[model samples]
Every structure is written in structure tokens, then in C-alpha cells.
Target: MLQDTTSSAPLRSLLFHLSDVELLTRSARQIVEEEAPPCYTLLIFTNGTGRLYIDNQPFLFSPDHCYLLSPGTSLQIENGTDTVVCFYRITFTVIQARDQQQVLYTEDIFPNRYELRVYPLSRLIRLTEQLYAGRLGKGDMEWFKQHLHFQELIGFLLEHNLHSDPSLSLTQSVENTIHYLNHNFMDSITVKQLVQLANVPHWQYTSIFQELTGKKPLDYLTELRINRSKEWLAISNAPLRDIAHRVGFADEYYFNRRFRQTTGVTPRQYAISMRQRVLVKDWTGHEVHIPLQPLRIIYYGETIGDLVTLGIHPIGGNIPNPENRLYKDPTTIIHDVGFPFNTERASALEPDLIIFANSDERQYEQISKIAPTITYNSWATLEERMHILGDWFGKKREAEQWLVHHHNKTKTMWQQLQSSINAGETASVFTYDHGERLFVMGVTGFSTALYHPLGFRPVSKIQDILDAGQGYKEIQESSLPQYAGDRIFMLLPENKISRRAAEDMMNSTLWQSLPAVQSGHVYMAEEAKWNFGDAFTRDKLLEMLPELLQGF
Candidate 1:
């Protein structure tokens, strides 16, 4: 009866009562009707960097941001990239009557469910703490006491939601601090200094910083200094003490210790790996004399898995999103050269060679100055990339071996898949990135792996994109039926909004009505794990596809 439709009308009275109040500390904690009868519940995250899911939709939780959930909404907290999540769950009820006649006006007191960000969140936290503390007492009087505070908290939310913009935002302040840290890594910095820069409480700043950068303030600072020091150690003949001082370290021993800890190698050992020369014309037509047997290499491209599979490990590389890893090994020692290539960090490694994937002349010029940079085409076929990598890195024999192995295994894999999959069945992959944007993969990404002559045919629209040589294209949701094939694959990204949108569509009647969905042929893949078009990811997809296709 309480879950009926709501209509706005004259409200003369409101019956609001606090039904429950508790602090959730565990990551696996869920608020279902069985555990605690679901009502209008407010989640006040005091400290958390975990993913919050409401009825299967993912949400990235931030401290001091209060999310109001509707009645009977399934709340599940899952681990994010970092941090243990903790939040206050305050459940309540609010109903309005028409014209003081006791006729039910509407159950819509505020919005059904929404996230509210108001300045000075300390006030809300204080009230929540007071209410949670009061809940520990055993009495009807305690319930009565907490109800008054609940009313005040509701009033605060309703009033503050009206303000469209606040002069100061905690997220904005932390973002600015991140910029500050990037530019000033050479300067002495601490967590306290960053907290002051953000102008927020110490506890709040920590969670916000971690959520934004996926690293603690001090840890981030240390990485920056070490990265800079790595460059100095390679390019300059400065003493270890001098390099330490210049890179913001107080002592040489401390700098040496941190460098070894982060890079998985001592500074001296890393330097010794860069030497010799082998002249070659790269894909971009630049004649670069690279290292004869490059050991300390920086691979700036999507084909990192190619190196991983080749038994040649790069000491440093560019992983735009750390989630989209080259391999499953968490201990890979590839230092990130940053997206689009952070030339400063690239030069810092003093790499003997830089295998950059971008074809942009401007960016190539910038990165080439750092090392013997070789620009390569990531769009090339797996065999093409391997052949080029082999010649460039003096692994011609190794390259030939992998191609033979790849072709043989690939032929065998599709032969197995052909048994279960119907002939001429088309397969398509799409994803929602950052927001509601829907992008259909064409010749690149998982499509390259899936669209073998023996495997699956491409849908008409996607085939056109493949002909046009475009990696992906955004299409209207209405065109999904046309673009969708006999088999559907959805690559869900790490972005919170994108994941939620994809999840919502999956639950929608329209999505359920799709022919692929009806036949239970729809598959979902993590963007980080499967969305790469690189030969390495394509190879991994070979092993992954059979299991996913057959659901074995």
C-alpha cells in the first residue's frame, strides 16, 4: 500500500518517523528487507572508496555525499579499487495527508532517491553520529529522542538541496590538490599539506583523494619524486645524494629505498639495463637507432600484452587505465608513462627505447626527445605488430614462433567454437563509456578477436565501420536492434556512470526483448580485461571466448 503512485497536492500534515539507524562497517554488508525492513533509507558515507550498488546499479561512493535510497531498494557494497567502505544507514518514513482531512496526499516527501552534496557536511555527519550513538541505548525514550534528530536531518537535506551551487566543493578542492601535487612533486609535501590545500577535514580529504587518484596523498607524492629521480639518475651523472635532494628526498638512503620499493629494481640495476644500438626505420618512417637489446624499455601503446606474451617484459610502459592491465599479474613492474605519454616521466626512466603506438607527429616529436622513440601503428593485425616488434627489438625468430603458435591455436579455437555456434550467426560488441553514450565496436577491440572467417559474422552497420577503418562509433539506442547481431556482447567499463547505464539497460524490457537476450546469447565483459584491440588481448580473448560463448 505504501509503494503506490504519488501525486502532488496540498499537504496539511506529515507523519515522519525514524524506523532504524545503524553504522555499516563491513564491505559485504547489505540492507535488504529481511535483514532490516527497507524504508526511505539515507546512506551517509563518512569514509569509503568502495563501489555502492543499489538493486544492481553501480555507484562510486564518496565521503560526505549522502544518498537517499527508496523503499525496498537492494543495497550492496562491493570492493572498489581501494579502501574499506563505511557509511551510516538511516531509515525513515514520511507520508503526507491532503487538506488535514487524513486523506493520503502522497508518499513523495522529497525526491524518491538521489545523491545530495552540500557544503559543510560536518553538520550532517555530526547529527548522524548523534543519532547512531543514541540508537545504542535500550528504551522507547531513546527512540523518541532519535526521532527528533531525524526530523532535523530531513529538514537540513530538503533545505540544502535547493542551493544549486556552493562556493566551495570538496571534490573540486581535492582535484585542485591533485594538480598541485603533480606540478610540485619536486617540493617537500605531506598529507597534512595536501589536506590544508584541499581545505577539508583530514579524514574526508583522504577518502576523496583516494577515490579521485586511486592513491594515498603521501604515496602519490613519493611516486612522483621517485619517477623524477629515475630520470635524473639516467641522464645525469649526479651523486645519489644530489639526485635525492633534487627530487625532494631528504636523504640518499631514503630515496634509494623508496625507488627500489616502487620500481621493483634498485636505481643502479635499472640504469645498467639501458645500452647498445640498432638502427631501424619505424612504422611512422622515423629512422631511430634503438637499443641493440633493449632491456629497460618503455612501451607506450595498447599492444603491451604482445610484450607479455613474447617473454620480453618492459621495465616501464603507458597504461592509460591501470584497470586495463597488460596481464593478470598484479606485480608487473611496468611504470606508467601516462596517457598520451608524459614525456617528463618517460625521460625520467632513461629508457633505452620507447615503443610508442601513436601516429601523431606532434606527440611523436615530444616523446622522441626523451629516448630512441619508435612510433608504431596499433591498428595493424596481431601478426603485423609481432613482425614489426620482432625486427625492431631484434626478436625476429621469436616473432615468427609466436605468429605460428597464434595461427595454429586460433584455427583450432574457432574449430571448437563452430560446433556450438550456428553457421552465419553474427556477433557484435558495444559499451557505454563515462555516461549514456553507446559505442559499437567495429574492426577494433573485441570485434577483431570475434570476427574470424570461421567464427561470427559482423552486423551490417558494424561491418560498414570495419570497412571505414574506425575503431568504434556512437549510435542512438533506437538503432540497437539493427546493430545488434545474433550474439550480443556488452563490454562494461570501470566508469561508474557507464556501468550503471549498462546495468539499467540490461534490466530494461527493451533489452530483455532483444532476440539475443531471449535466446540467452547475450554476454558481458569487463572493458579492462577484454576491450583492448591489441594482439595480446586478442590472444587472451581466444582462451576466454570459448568459455564465454558456450557458457562453460
Candidate 2:
């Protein structure tokens, strides 16, 4: 029997080393990647469409499609489309394979193979972000946990046909059935329906599905419904019956019984417990028990704007003391946690909950000792982070409402600005980081929101920079005209070095000759407010953007 390697049958050491992983964004017509060393590679396309060549074999790839290549494989991806293509690549090696037969048997899983499969990017994207950000520490315990996460990822791929034989008709049939179940889990599903979809006998369909996924077809459907129900239970105030029906259960009583059987807790108990305190899994993948409605909270992260938007004012946070207060109408009494955050002072605030960015991981342990701490990826997209915060705070409705309002406001403002600004007019954002370090912002902070759908378009050069996934490009003052667009928003960083650079730029003839400058389309932006992509910052941008875009 070819047993499923992902199943629990462990022995001996299985050492692994991760070479690199990244979410690459590209807009160039032709982009080629070459590596000196031969290793296993995995690619997941999340945006746009492109043709990828593994060696000489071409595979037409698009969003939600995944590719796995064996050792010594070479890749040449081409994006002929005008839209930007974004994909994630992960490279790693298995140094010491387990000596056991089960482990050794799966060693040649993708041998001489360039396999394309279907795997949802949502699950894999979060894991890739965690690994890329180093939120999982380098400690032995953390390493073990990271390895488990990798195993889970691999298991997901395998379940979808990473190791399945293409010649086997039953394999494809089982896969289709699984896909059907996944997409229609909210509808009443039965063995007869699944078997009909698989186009196979009831017994045969169940047998192959169990062999491939290690779960019976009906059992798999139940698990999917239960998992989705857990998400709704944590984030919504929906009643038990409504929640049960939402996840495909015919009755609330049956849903309660099945939920208890699977999770060892009833639906109502789970909801009540979560209402008091819930176990939150953050970007680090750590399940930390936190208060559902925290009274006193502090955060040592750049998402103060997001916290403020949620209407839960933090007792203390890493609020910047900028020379110019960007957003006025300040009502929350905030205790500054100091630069890099003063742990001792943070403790003095008597906060019951603490939040930090995954980037600021060094302070996690020390700060965690004072209060329960959770970390979020500060670098993720604005929508991604906002939805995550909304889920954690059980304010999804509020988040959705704010987004709707922002969308309406942005639409109206764009319509109004069209009178002065041409339809194809371009914009660019620049910031003075320090002495001689001039950065052109890409898809982050204010730049991201500014270049959103129906918003101003970026210049070709800046668009290429963004497509290449460069957060900010450092450029010389003399090169400003090349990157500057019809309109420019220049951020003034609050530092002596930046002050010196700003003085130098102000004195330069190169700065005065730019098209945007000649037309008086250049505006000064407060660094703190313009550089952050949080809800508060976004709202502030909404309030100020029309004024900035007025009169062309």
C-alpha cells in the first residue's frame, strides 16, 4: 500500500533548510530567474496571468494555480499582459530524510516532475508572510513549530495531487469530488451527490477519497463545515440556528451535537466563551488567549490609526510626536510608549492587552511577560490588515461599513477631481528618509491608497517600480524628473538628516524644473501620516486628498 506520508507515522530525524521565499511582483514583458544551485521550488500565482517555462516545457499559469518543480529545475516566466503579475516562490531543501520506509518512500514525490495543481492562495499567503517576516523566532521550539507549519503546507499540496499519478482516472475523479465539496460546503451535501459528481460508484468514490485525503468523503465534508462554523462563531454575533444553516447544517440541534463531537464544546458554550475571552492566532501562528473586549490595551506597532478607527483607544501606544499633528480632533488620552517602546513604562500603564508588529519581534518575549501580546504583519495590504483587526476585535461589520464609506467618498472625490485633472494624469510619491536618501514610495502607506482602483494612476517608471515589488526606491535628486509624474506628494521626514536633505533639495535647480513643480502640483505631506497605511491614516488621506488634488 502507498500510504499517505503526511499521516502520523514518525521516526528518525527529518532535517530541512529553507533557502528563500518571496512574493515577487512583476510587470515587465520578460522576467527570467536563474539559480546556481539545484533545489526544489514551489510557485503560487496570486495575481495576473503569465506563461512559465520549467526547463523547456511551457505551462500557462494564472491566479490560484500552483506549480511544483523538482531539483535542478529552471524557471523562465514571461508576463506579456499589461497588468502586473504577482506570484510567490519558495525554495527549500530536505537535508536529512527520515530513514523509515514511509518517509523514504516519498523522497521521489516530484521526481522529474513539473506539476501544476490547484491550491488556494489565502492559506499559503499568510504562512509565506509569516516566514518572510521572521515572526516565528529562531529558537529551537519556534523552529519545530515552523517545521510543523511547513509540513501542514506540504500536506495541503499533496492532498490536492502533488504526488498523484496523472494516468489514474480515479485520482482525477476523487480530486474533482474534493473540489466540489470545498466549493459547495455551504449547501446540503451527501454521499450520493459527491459520488455522482465523481462519476463513480459510491463505494469506489469513498475508497479513493480516503486513500487520497485520508478522510472519508462525508467525513471531509463535515470537517469543512465545522471549520468554517468556527470562524463565524468567533467573529460574528449570529444566532446558533442562523450560523448552523450558514454552514449547511439542516438543524441547529444537529449542528450543536456535531460541533460538540468535533470540538468538545457546544455551539452556545463556544460563543459565550469567545465573548469573554478568545484564543487568537496571530501572524506568528501562536494561539494566545486574550480578552474579547479588552478595557485597557497598548500597542507598540504602527497601527495606532487602525486601533483608533475601531473606537477602542489604547491607554498607551507608539504614537509619534511629530512636529505637525497630522490628524486633529484628538480626544483619546494616550501615554507614549517611547521610541522602540519603553517596556518598563508600558508595564506601568497597567494594560491588560499588548499588541506589536511582527517586524518588531525582538521585544515580544519581554513585553509578553507584562501582558498578553499579539503581533500582526504591519507590512501586509491595507485591506488585509484591516480585515484581520476587525476579526480579532469582532468588529467585521464596522470594518465593512468603514470600507463602504471610504469607497463612496473616494468615488465622489475622483469624480470631482476630474474637472481639474485629466483622466490619464499620473501621480508620484517621494519621501526624504535621511541625508542623501530619497525614496519613491510604492504599494505601501499612502501610496497604496492613492493608487487604488479608480484613483490616480502612477507614472510608468513608478508603476514598474511598484510591479517589481520594491516598497520604496532610493533615487538621486537629479533623477527626480524621471520618476516624478503630473502630480507629486513629497513627504518631509522628521529628522536632522531629512531636514538637511530637504534643504539641499529645496536649493537644487533640479527640483524646481520638474513638470509637477512648474505646474504647482507638488505638495508637502506630513511624514508620519503619509507613511502609514492604517485605518486612521486612510481616513485622514480621504479627508485631505480632495484638497491636495484641487485646482489640478
Candidate 3:
């Protein structure tokens, strides 16, 4: 592509038509992906570190990177933390002046694999603003103007991308040192050696290393040694001096002191506690020994609202998308551990216990080294989960009391609604998201609440899905009534495309003819606020249900 441009092509000879420009923002734990159309797509990540994949080729997306995807290349960006990712997508067709009908060129363009950074991004942003400024305009003159602006924008991207940021180069060196330290930690290593690898001054290297790992170079190395020693101590009958020497310690006494400082216990005491811990089986059938009265907990799961409701605030956990009303407590003090479990960050927190809530054994293998980790079932019913937690935390009395209180409150709320609800009436939930794709709830979200014994009965198809262990199932618009029931819940998504899809469905003859729609049993709810069934959410529903069905 560069050869074509530099080979002496004039302005009209290499014209590329700009088809669309759209800005998108992804919230925490959200994924935005799509199959490519017959145009090249430029993805400009304005900010945040997201995981990016183009046709399964993964790349780290930070504030500096922009990706150029070829036609029919799949694109996926997963924002795995609390930071919102904002980006611009530019889709355009390449026009070859000498082609038949001058249509889009089918061959892959050069630099179609562009994953580049334009330092001083304001220059690119200004040119992009010009392109977006003209997106709403129409007609041949506007098209011609947009085409020229697109050329200018593409030119600026090419020019600035040739130069790489010096800080980025330095950071790459720091990351390389980190990767080295992670693998070579058993060998004798020093802060000076790591700093040399970073190729920066001592102070600057320390700052960058700490910024990335939340610890100084020497401290991080020591942590690796100590964590490794802990594994040996737990599983092997190794002598303290031998363990110290194997983990890169020249002196066992110094290792003892460092371990004591890091763990608030001597090496001997730690070994003893490991033997004395309460052994229990985790959700995924792993036997783990947990510390008695353990504090400084790190929780990774969707049922954080359960922890909040039980008055047990973990030292670290992820607060997924702030829009969740149940988990939006101003007093919640859990540090964001990141979704997908940022194990390094969790290790830095010095957690005594880690409550991981996924069944991925590979992820479990990594996190278990951070602390005594257990895999939990976030999908378990509230009472069962609470009882399990009560057993683990020695809060059986509190758990039972909370459950009894919840039962009485929900019973009262259901009695109030008994006069309004029809006997044997069923309910079904549907939502549109992921760019107008529609789904029917089965075992997840408020379906968990609506299928409660005291709540609405699930339609037969939905029950079948629940028995089959599906959270939700996607279906075409024509199949809505087949899965919908006497009471319908239309969960409004945050995105405009899905909102429009929901609107189109509500206006359709099929939707209008549904029994729920005709009998005024159709309800609208915010997907963000009501699409969960954790203890906190279920408790919130005690207050919300009456209002939602006030006139039912």
C-alpha cells in the first residue's frame, strides 16, 4: 500500500471513500465485537487497557494503539476492568481508479495489519474530529469533502505512526524485565540488573517498575522468592535453609525476617498454621485449607452483592459496572481486583484468602499461589451460597438470621402482590443487546428471581432451558411469542441499537398480538439495574416488586 502511494500517484489516483465513523464506549466487563464488512476498519482506542483480538490474533490495547483491520477480519475488544474504554471506529472502502466499475478492491491492502501508535495523539484526534463532523452530512459535495478529509486523516496516521514514543520504548524494556524476573526469580538477581534491563536511570526505573508491579524491583523479586518458598514449605519436607537457598536467598536468617515481615508470622509459625487450617472442599471439588477467621480477603465473582449484603466487605474485589444499583453502595470499600482476576494485583494486596468464583482450573492454578484460593459457585441459589459462606466464615448464625429475615420480608411483599397476580400466570424476560441481538432469559439474571417458588412460573420452554443449564438463549424476532409467557419483561439495554430493536419489536404486529402485551401485563425494566439475582438484588426487589407491579 505504501509502495502504491510513494510511486508517484496523484490525488484522484488513490482515492479511498469514507463510509462511516462511529464512536463507542464499553463499560467494565463489556465486550464489543463484530464480523467485518466489505471495508477496511480503523479502530482508534482513545484510552484504557483492553484485550483486543482480530480473528484470534491477540494484542494488548492501551491508550496509544490503533488497529487497522482488513475487510472480513473479525474484531473483538474486551474491557476487563472498571475503566471504561472509549474508541472510534472508522469504516471505509478502498477504491482503485483503474478497476472495473471502480468498486471496492477485494485484495487485502498493505498495512491492513496496522497496530500502530501516533505520538501526540491530538494531531490524529483533530483530523478524526473533522471526519466525524461530516458524518451527518449527505449529498455528492459532502461525499467529496469527506473523501478528501479521510485522505488527510489517513495521511496523518501514516506520518505520525512512523515515530514511536520514547516512553513506550522504555516501558517495553520494563515489561521485558518483569517477564524475565517472573521466570528467573530462583536465580540470584539484583535491582541493578533489572534496572539495567529497563535501560533507564535508577529512580526512573524504580518508578516504572513500581507503577507496573506495585512493588520496587527488589521487593517484587523478594515476593516471588517468598511465594515460591511458601509452596515448597506446604508440600515438601524441606529444611528452612535449603528452601531459602533454592528460592535465591543467600542467608536463611534474612529469608526468615522477610517472610515474617511479609506474612506477619515467622516461617515456623506459617508452616504450623498451614497444618492447622480448616480444610474444606470448594465448589469445583478442590480441597483447600483456609485460615481461621481469615481477613484481608480478595473476592472475584459476580455475586459480590451477596458479600455486601452479609456485611462482609473484602479487602479487594471488582465492582463491576457502576450502573448496577445493588452493588453501587457508597460505603463499599473493596479495591478493584479486576475482572478475569488480576493475580499479580491480588498478590500485591497480600490477601490471606482468595474467593475465586469461576470453575476454570487453569486460572485457579495461577491464583492459588497468591493465597489459599477457593473456587465458588456464583450461580448457586442465595440460601445455599449463604450457608456455604457461613460455614467458611463461621457466621452460621448471621447467615441463618439474614435468610430468615429475607424470607419473611419476601413473603410479606408476595402477599401484597397476591391480590394482583393471577393464579398459574407465567413470566418471561427478553433483552436486546450486542448490537440488536435478542435473547431470552433462562437460568440467569432476574430469571432467577422470577422463577422462585413464590414468584411467577416459568414458561415450559424456559424451564427446559433452565434444566439444560443455559443462562440465556438467542432467538430470532419471529420466535418471541413461542418463548414469551403471560407476563412479559422487556429488559431495556443501554445501547441505542438494542433500544431501537426493542422499540421495533414492541411496534410489531406479533408483539401487539401477544397475550401479555394485549392484557397490559407487559413490563419494562432497566437491564443494568434489574438484571441480576444476587442477595442484594433480591433484597432490593423486595422494595422494587411492589412498585413495578403497582397497577398489575
What residue runs in model 3 are displaced by over 4 Å at the alpha carbon?
A: 1-276, 327-331
Indicate whether candidate 1 or candidate 3 has the larger TM-score.
1
TM-score of 1: 0.53
TM-score per candidate, chains pooled: 0.53, 0.48, 0.51
Q: Specify the poorest-scoring 10-residue window by lDDT in model 2.
A: 1-10
Note the clash tally of each candidate. 1, 0, 0
* Candidate order, lDDT descending: 3, 1, 2
Poorly placed runs, candidate 2 (over 4 Å): 1-275, 322-331, 468-471
Candidate 2 backbone clash number: 0
Per-residue lDDT tens digits of candidate 3, residues 1-552?
Answer: 011221222335555777899766787678887767878899876544556778886555655357777788888888775556667789987766664456446454433334655556655665565576456445688678777889878877656544444565456557657756765678888888777655677888889888988998899899989977875665446789999998999989999999999999988787766645689899999998887756567888877777777777776877554434343322233566777678877887677789998899999999999889998888777898899998888788988999999999988887778888877889999999889899998776877777655668988888888898787899999888889899998887767898778888888999999999999888777676678767888887776667667731
Measured by lDDT, the strongest candidate is 3
Candidate 2's residue-wise lDDT over 218-254, tens digit each?
A: 7888898997687567656888899899999999999
Displacement of the residue 116 alpha carbon in candidate 2, Å: 70
Candidate lDDT scores, in order, read 0.71, 0.69, 0.74
Decoy 3 TM-score against native: 0.51
In candidate 2, the residue pairs with backbone N, CA or C atoms under 3 Å apart (3 or more residues apart, or in different chains) clash, namely: none
RMSD of each: 16.3, 22.3, 13.7
- Least lDDT summed over 10 consecutive residues: which range in candidate 3? 1-10
